[model samples]
Target: MLIAYARSLVYQEQAVRKALLELQNPRRKRAFGGTLTLGEFSLAPHLKTFFQGHPDVDFSLKIDNTKEVMSLLEEGILDFCLVEGLFPKEGYDVVLLKEVPFVLLVSPGHPLAKERKVSLEELFAYPLILREEGSGSRDIVEKALAERGYDIHGFQKIIEIGNISLMKRLTEEALGISFMYEDAARKELAENTLVQVAVKNLHLTREFNFVMMKNHLEKDEILGYAKEFQGFFAKEAGRF
Candidate 1:
């Protein structure tokens, strides 16, 4: 059985393609091996719709940190990864997908929630909840703060959380404020569960990229999959 490990975003596309492939070659379905393993960040939702009709192939999902995912790729435990922040490593090939803005999120009733924008200096007055060190989100936040002369040591109060969902929940419950992708908090903001707090003159943005080891460059399946995924992202750029 041929296997491919990927991020959650490809689940729907995988299902659509698999069904079409099977339909066109029902008699010799065994010719092409079919199996997919998916791992994703906590923010990525389940992709059940994509796997509805393809039951022959094994599909497994695991929740792992970004560092773990990258390590798996290096060890050949995964075929590729769709993640943000990190640049391409020496042995890896990367395709830049899209850039996402990092913004502060707070509950609707929080004081800063009413402000159109707050500077990094002003944000220091409040407690901060952040992701673990290797996380893309954490890296972006640290860089943005450092450029403004706000070192980690200067943060008034800090709390570290490994899970993105938990960080959002804590922010909502007023445990502390956090910074995250604007899209990730869209629903919560619209529903009043959270509010976006702008940072004055600071545009903390990061690019989301797809990556695979260089050895996989010529593999037809991997290349085809990459192209399809990249096309999908290009089409959806405006929505994000």
Candidate 2:
């Protein structure tokens, strides 16, 4: 793709400049972006430990929807991106980091809260609080529903939101049921502010990937962060 080729060229040029800068200063600077879910559950927590180990490294993080973050990557505003939604792999090198469950979330007071599992037909009775278009989680949900011959239109009502934390707060207020990666609501789930509503016959899982432009001069350097994040994620998983 022309876009990919252009991005590759830009990265190569920037790499040369970065190399020159490094010669004058031993400190390194990098920027990373990730989808909201990964930012909340993984990146934010891992960065604390990462900073402790590499005090001289100046790493910055940007959190946004998959589409926006990918745009940042293409513009060279980010060194790499971590995402949980589907993306074009043609021009990018990727690492599959982890697979996490995708689940429906409801407030404890919602009518469906007591159900162990419900059919798709039952869920259509309640309002759906969903991410706005161009979001990775929204795309995943749409694709999964299409496979079952349904769409968001099937819901009684639709509430479009762009913020993950606000979405969870609204869900907690019993405004509507929402769908997201399980880990995104881990804290709320632990506090019983939210509950998972399983859908019968609908099992969904998504992969977290470290994606970067192909032929990156610092591919290994970026991967060092990815590897460290994975280690922290695995250690945290053991406790949960």
Best by TM-score: 2
lDDT string for model 2 (1-240, tens) is: 787788778777776776788789878888889898898776777776787888888878899989999988876778899998788888888888788999999999999999999998899998999999999999998999999999999999999999899999999999999999988898999999999989999999989999887776688888887787778777877887
TM-score of 2: 0.92
Give each prediction's root-mean-square deviation over alpha carbons. 8.5, 1.8
The Cα error of candidate 2 at residue 5, in Å, is: 2.6
- Worst window of 10 by summed lDDT in candidate 2: 40-49
Q: List the residue pairs that clash in candidate 1.
A: none
Q: Model 1, range 103-159, lDDT digits (tens) per residue?
A: 889887788888998877887777899988777677778887778777766766889
